[model samples]
Target: MPPLLRLVQQQGVIMSERKEGQSIEEIYADAVHWHVNTGGETIHAKRMGGRFRSLKWWTGSLWLLFFLSPYARWEGHQAILFDIPHRQFHFFSLTIWPQDIWMLSLVLILLAMTLFGVTAVAGRVWCGYFCFQTVWTDWFTWLEDKIEGNPIQRRKLDAAPWDARKIRLKLFKHSLWLLIAILTGVTFAGYFTDIYRLWVDYLTLQAPLVAWVVLAAFIFGTYVFAGFMREQVCFWLCPYARIQGVMVDKDTILPTYDAKRGEPRGKSRGGDEARGDCVDCKLCVAVCPTGVDIREGMQEGCITCGMCIDACDSVMEKVGRPKGLIRYMSEKEMLGERLPPLYRRPRVIVYSAIFLLSVSGILYGLTHIPPVELSVVHERQPLFMQMSDGSIQNKYTFKAVNKTPEDLRLRLSVSGVPGLQLLAADGDTVTLKSGKTIPFHVFLRARRTQLKQANTPVRFRLQGIDKPEISLEYESVFIGPSKA
Candidate 1:
């Protein structure tokens, strides 16, 4: 063949191989690397570094406090403890008893509202950054990434036949996962009991049944959910994901694909000028933890983790194109609509208002938590009896719960019943155990002639003998039979 003919043949071959203006369907066909899971297979999410990735690491670090707090000491006692056995929550200098459980409700409300408000503003920011499920799953995947290489290597290993190398890697990875799971279980249990003692018990194989159960459950959950289930937990198990639709709206910013800027996908070698920025690479799909293509539009499987954004940005940078092929944006912003201020959005305003109210209530409850709880129950079976000394006597039972860590001595007395005399079997002073409720019988006597009504309001007060500032009072009715 002539030289020109040979050159033309080579050019024809090159032209036939050069892919241009690849339709979305063709791109989808090329993306055999990713699978959108539906509870059938494990997802191996590719991990990469970016601004949001660093932010995720920082937020995940907060859970370290959960592990370390039980070891913290406050005046020779655990700094923070649930103390479920004793029915008290100790926080540094403050002790909360069952009487103050109302505060916990406010605390729950505060947390719930905060989650709602954040979701309304930025979709699944918690799932991406702070949620324990997400954090633990990220950690598990990170470990997997380090040990098994990237997602492709992990899948290959998974499909590889049983062998020494594979077994060794699997064993090491699972061993570390189980270690973390056990630590998570123990750490969670520590919050309820003495952490040091709990550790000793576990070491000695003497942990209580409940402690063992908690450890087993957490271990199983962490290993399965974080190590195996990964993002599927966010998809199916989490109620927040389902309800976040209502919380998130057109203004809610999320990891979004700019279809206007990224559509008309083509290949790098094609040089198709009509095509948008996307190169049909599917790097975004490859990097997604949930395997949902952001270009398909926002779906429940999307955790809004921004990994896709990072992946897309990296791809764009490599292609010598401007970044933000996928970016954090709202639907309205994508549509070129001006966004209202946070205070102006009705959803945001309502969420913020409720969040503020919940926070205020929690703060109020914490500040106003009574140092002690006192109750007096008038003996109801007999109401009142006539004493031999020509006085009407009322029997009462006084219960006092000392919220403080130290024992308290209280000078118990009564008033508001004219000519009334207070008497107790244990004398005028009673000692209360720290964080324990003690009940004692008492008597109130008044001259029958001085009694003017069938029911008289009476006041019971206890003055702290050692701590005069710590005092409590209760009011009760001194009842007698109605006049015939």
Candidate 2:
């Protein structure tokens, strides 16, 4: 072989070997790294105390309000009740009827905007702190801790065979969980009906089938999702988790490991010799509720709960090192770039604008809710009738709904052209039932000389006799013969 050709072949072989070595190194590194969590194994995360841990406990306890809110009473009625059968929502002194359902749309918009704004600012704070899955799982795990001890002991119990002592403990824990599940179901159903009356109906086996179905669904869902599924629900079931990536940007702050400072990690000994602060204790992974090794970089399982930060900080304290080995930071900040204020962030600004608009619409809807609603239909069979006295008459069916809580005596009147007279309604008083629409035929008569066109604009006004504040006006066209 020629010397140049041989040298070229040798260089190619060396480069190929280097590429092969790189591939092997990557596979070995991945093997050493803790990757994503699958639902196959039960995660037994260690519990520890720190600022974030305390915050989690406090936020989790806020869910107790959901279980207790149904029992609250005001003015001899459920304070916050959704009377679905009556199509009413009562909140203390305020009543919302189906007519006011637009407010509900605004409310939903407000909630969505708030979620978007918060997600854009801090990633998944709602999931970390206030989500039903997180809160219920926390409660279930706390109960487990009380009954079966910490993560280590819980793992042992899981591995243990069905002995008498194990069976007793397991039975006790399950019984408690079942009770909680039942209570959660009942409380959810209580919101739609009177809580005390529902209890009576349930005990008597007279509750509606729909209510029973809802209770059963809630019970099963709570037991399975909170008690068993736990983090798996966040991983595979929650649609919010899937879409949160789009909502969060690089500016969004999240619980993250400082890779620049912590890489090339080694166990911290008394003597420092070119090593990062990480002691390689694995305490962060041990305390992670989702079994995430945050130091490996952010993963889908990281809920940004800051639990790892708490765990690492406690370990740092114990090892007499400065805290915040794992901390909440934005990508920009982590890359040594300046972060703009929240208002300057485009996502935050847009979300805030939408939130404000939704809130304003809701406020306007609530404040401008009319006391009465009116609809008028002009009779089409015979547009106008010729009276025996040579007068032209028009007939209309008026529907007036009294939205107030009391029955009202309404005085009906019409105004349009000169010489217009109202007939059929005697003494000008029409009775209206509370929350009911009353339909009645009304006739309007006018002299033939008063008719000016084929159709003339007319107004109908209703004034409440008992409560003058309850009034409404509607405009309609009155049909008449065209002038010759």
Candidate 3:
């Protein structure tokens, strides 16, 4: 049978012949009219109240932390700052330096695994609920709805001539959008510098050129991407949409139309028992933010937001039919196959393992961060010198980095060889400047007769004079002449 005839049969109504010399091609074309939005015109999605809509709003509110977190203070400084110029990251009482940047790799891995795992299981819930693009577009549209009115009125206003009322609404909406864009830019820039001073500089127009450039870029991106592009970004720009097919499988549950129950769609009339449950109301298409026709099947534009599910359920209730004409259902369920447990899925298992390992590594690195770093470089040129007193001397350079918040007076000593002595000074001490690496020279002498080998393992110890509990050690090789 032809595709249109098969579709009709699936709807429980099969027509043996076309109407009045109509060809199969014409019949199929008329029956299946799948429309895709290509950004030629604007889409004014109708807003509806439902459980998923409420959930979307709740999740989007989490972005408020982005605007408000920079102002939070901890110990006379911003609570969380990247401090890129100083090569430090501060979070509350803890600080991370360049030497500990490996933790950042683990953090990135954790985030990637989380995204993959969620996509494999739920199918783009992040894009629907928590993505910055989705949240900002929702916000912009909400404001548009409040200022202009419903979708019908907004469309009319756009089509209306340049009248005073239309101009006022457009100007007001754009001004509010620009304000949000500016705030977004400033808040982002505040993460790398002192937010209060940054705000003052921006207000006075005295900020550095780099700061101005960053602000301008962010403002332009936010205003254009969130306000004008809307769902077009998800359709044409997002790489995630292109790769989602590989991430999801038959077991993945998504907002799906029940063809078995909703086929042969027609309006229920007086004593018409042959019609299916769907009333051909098209409520699902009206409420979709992306203008996806769920009845046509899952499309690239579907974000799995579940808005159509809510709309379909509402229509089903109003028409005295069962709910869930559209719902989150996997292909296996549609085909009467049982879905395996999440742990049994290969991708989920791998993703969960990587996610756990990355979290563990990050925690271990953060908790085990050292308070000081030390390295010793033995002098290569003239590694050993014969002193006039018939003693052998060796030169070494010590580089110590103080990671503490305060300077320290450190007493230094050497061990590992008998009859060794400090040629520079006995019981000597050096000062370590806070948050800096300073290099200094140390000389050690040993009696010639005490030399047992050409190379000897030596340990250098640094003890804090004021805080005796602070001790650090570095092991180095002391070079000398061959035993004779």
Best by TM-score: 2
lDDT of 2 by residue, 1-484 (tens): 3322232232221222234446543433443356667788998788788898899889988988998899999877799999888788888767788888988988998999899999988898899898999888988888898899999899899999999989998999889889899899999999999999999988999999998999999989999999999999999999999989889876888887775566446786658656667888999999888998877666678888888999999888998878887998876777778878997999999989989999999888878878777889999989999889988899999887777677888898889978899986565789888777769899999888887888989998899788887778889878888786
Model 1: worst 10 consecutive residues (lDDT sum): 6-15
What TM-score does structure 2 among the candidates reach?
0.91
Candidate 3 Cα outliers beyond 4 Å, as residue runs: 1-32, 422-427
Ranked by lDDT from best down, the candidates are 3, 2, 1
lDDT of each candidate versus the true structure: 0.82, 0.83, 0.85
2 versus 3: better lDDT goes to:
3
Which candidate has the highest lDDT of all? 3
Quote the RMSD, in angstroms, for model 2. 6.8
lDDT of 3 by residue, 114-161 (tens): 999998888889898999998999999999999999999999999899
TM per candidate comes to: 0.91, 0.91, 0.90
Candidate 3: what lDDT? Answer: 0.85
Q: After TM-score superposition, what is the CA distance of residue 238 in candidate 2 from its true location, in Å?
A: 0.7
